[model samples]
Target: MRFVDEIYRLYKGHFNGDEEDIVAIIVGILEEQSHQDLLKLVAEMDEEELFHMLATYMVEVMKRKVAMDDERPPATLTH
Candidate 1:
């Protein structure tokens, strides 16, 4: 599987019930914008942009989780 696919699979069980759209968006964005140097770009993305992207997707996944009712955890990028 691709890196993004691996991420989706790894977190599939944690999405509660809102993963489909999130996965589609993320994969779409990555496939379109993250070309051959995806890893390097991810590592070098500005803090704001990186976290924004991370938080957006996380919110999508956590839609059914009570813990996210009013809280957003720290963002992260896994290689």
Candidate 2:
């Protein structure tokens, strides 16, 4: 199965009744310019590229979230 299809399958059971597409939520929140284009680019990448991309993107997201949390410490941050 494709990575996205597999993710949908694995999480299908855990999704809330109104929350059908977890991947869409992720993509939707991205800046408007790359919204659909990003997915197209991602689709052409190999597994290794996907892994690194996801890991890097996730870590950056997490770092930003953590930094924004008032209870946490912040450093000069960049994506």
Candidate 3:
């Protein structure tokens, strides 16, 4: 998956973890479509379908962040 590899390479400087673990987490969370399947899907999409998909993803990300925050302690300045 060149797309996945490219993203990993681009952000490796900022991320610290086993590369395999990172890749596993990413591939596990996303729908298991190959790059070619993704290309076909995009090729066949109308603007409305793409927009709706993006909006749904954003909502899911926001919900996950909120849920994660609820599980953590409140932050404090430690200086």
Candidate 4:
């Protein structure tokens, strides 16, 4: 539950919908991936490596968000 809360906090503003729903969505996506390999790699990772991996993933998500925002036209102010 603590881990779920942490993930929810990390992804709060970045995703749409409620925190629980978003967390479930993320978990579902991961479950659909080649998870055996991911599990093996995670088992071999040290704490620092895990931290770096999470940080990198967050950075990539942020970059994608920025790119998507950039594609939208700026809001105009009308007099």
Total clashes, candidate 4?
A: 0
User: What is candidate 1's lDDT per residue for 1-79, written digit by digit as tens?
Assistant: 2555676786676566676767675676677764556777677667887899799879878885766755886778899
- Ten residues in sequence with the least summed lDDT for candidate 2: 25-34
Per-residue lDDT for 27 in model 2?
53
TM-scores of the candidates in the order shown? 0.35, 0.42, 0.54, 0.48
Error of 3 at 19 (Å): 32
Top candidate on TM-score is 3
Global fold similarity of model 1 (TM-score): 0.35
Q: Weakest 10 consecutive residues, lDDT, candidate 3?
A: 1-10
Q: Give the whole-model CA lDDT for all candidates, comma-separated.
A: 0.70, 0.69, 0.75, 0.76
lDDT of 4 by residue, 1-79 (tens): 3444665688777677667777687787568658685677677777887898899999999999999999999999999
The local distance difference test score of model 1 is 0.70
**Candidate 1, backbone clash total:** 0
